[model samples]
Target: MIKHNIGLTSAEIGGLWEAFFQETMSVCLLKYFLHHIKDEEIKIVLTKALDFSHLNIKKIKEIYSKENIPLPDGFSEKDIDLSAPPLFNEPFALSYVYIMSRMGMINYAFITANIARSDILSFFTNALAQVTELYTDATTMMLSKGIYDRPPKISYPKKIEYIQKKSYISGFIGQKRTLNAVELTEIFFNIERNYFSILFCLGLIQVVKDKEIKNFIKDGKRISEKQINFFNEILQKEDFLGIISVSMEVTDSTISPFSDKLVMSLFHFLNSIDITLIGHALSMSMRADLSTFYSKVIGEILLYAESGFSIMVNRGWLEKPPQATNRKNLESR
Candidate 1:
């Protein structure tokens, strides 16, 4: 039970870069293993992925050593059966990659900022650039083959600004004239994050494979579910306010941002979104006109954000950091 402290570390940032590769391999291999029955091309693809995973694993090990951080017992042959059929198929596999690459980019942007130390922060900046490049390459592959699931782009706005498809996702709220697109985005974004937390935690439990990883994932799942329901309750309270007439909706239909990595990517994206919403809450809280309940909910979300990051580490989705860096990040401001 890692006492899940707060804040960003260089190692964790690097670790996520490595984790993305690990997860990418996991999905690619899982899909090929299940469906490669007699297809030479799919087998070739699986072999190439296995090679990439092998190389990336070595690189990650080097990163851990460089940071003077111990690598947790990560995945191995014992955790999977090459002879066994894959639990996932092609459609889902592609979806997972597409969304997650976008999600990975978003998180790296945070890791770059959230990590204040020089060397550690540089590690993330470098990783972010590399991951961006990786994403671009993957996107090219998907585009060439016509398998990528692009994100929902908000079309260009005309009359009032750069608004696009957000209109469908948003609606007019009541009394408060200030509850425009930004406010509407906050509401639905918060709801989607809650939903993502629930689903990501659940998806993690399914393929954790290792004993420590599996138990950790299950524990995180429970925590995430509680937080999701908490957010849902808070949004319901917001409905009681005169801010807007539009009702909040948490649509469970998850969209694929990456070809196959939607689940993991959405999980990562939602975690980042929670942080953004917390910032919004804080800014709103400082206002003289904001309600007391909104401020309280902001306080609650702050703690829940800490918990969310903790669960990510516990599940091995987020890498643990070096003690020195960890201590500094957790220390009082």
Candidate 2:
């Protein structure tokens, strides 16, 4: 390990703190999956995933100890029940790991870019590399199994042509142009993500015991289904079929494998990711209709996320992050 005399900056602290919680939550979920997974190949992959989460937690704890920062009380064994019946089938477990690894890569890259300290930077850089390898492994396994949902293919243009008319960007008015490659790619990716979100919500909804929490998850499922239909309709209008994974399956198990706190926290984490992706899609989209749709759904998602936050706060489950000192109160004293 590289030794650094310099203390961590706010960005480094924030990133590490958030990562601690994320990895701990992942450890709980991955352990449950490992207990139920039967496929030897997938079992190996999940074991690797569990090991990575444990390693991350260990490193973060060391850093916190060196800095004299109290460790966050992240998810623990109490939050998960290993003996509960399997909530998802084998294929869905593999797919979940694949998608989560992709998300992890994005998150690690962002954190790595923001940190200046050499030690913290090295940690995130190594994390990015590990998650990238995991992503590749999952993807290769999916492809070999013929379960990968490939994006739609477009014919190669014979000649390079620039947009000569303003109508090329317009979609709500007369003579709307067919979806461009970039636009189609965003739509397809969003649809793919929502499909997974629907499955996740479906599995959780069946086992969640709290009435309010169950209703919240049910609302999330409905939103995902609506968004999928919206994106699919856009593709259908252009004579392109939407991509859906046939391997995604949720079991009929009603046994709760996770605490209500963990479930709510997971939903909040995923909602933040969904909002970020939709904002990126909005930036890439040029058509009025697509842009309008993204903007509207962002508001809807934000509202749902806020409701979840309120629920967590009311139940005293939301952990507050470190904040600046209250100078005003000190001055008054």
- Per TM-score, the best of the predicted structures is 2
Model 1, range 1-333, lDDT digits (tens) per residue?
885434435546554454644444454444444353354533444444445445555655675577565665543344334554343434333333434444556766865666665545665676566556555655666566565433223345567655354333233343222333344444444444444444445544555445554464455456555544554554455552212211222223232212222233334445455556556654543222233444655565555446545655565555333334457666865
What lDDT does model 1 reach? 0.47
What tens digits encode model 2's per-residue C-alpha lDDT throughout 1-333? 996589988899999988998999999999988999899999988999899989989999999999999999989999999989999989887887898898888888888999999889989998898899889989999988887887889998899899887776774456678888898888888888888888899899889888999999999998998889898887887888766657667889999999999999999988988898899999998888889999999999999999999999999999998787899999999
Q: What value does the lDDT take at residue 249 in candidate 2? A: 76
How much is the lDDT of residue 125 in candidate 2? Answer: 91
TM-score between candidate 2 and the true structure: 0.96
Candidate 2 deviation (Cα RMSD) = 1.9
Per-residue lDDT for 244 in model 2? Answer: 67
RMSD for each of the candidates = 11.5, 1.9
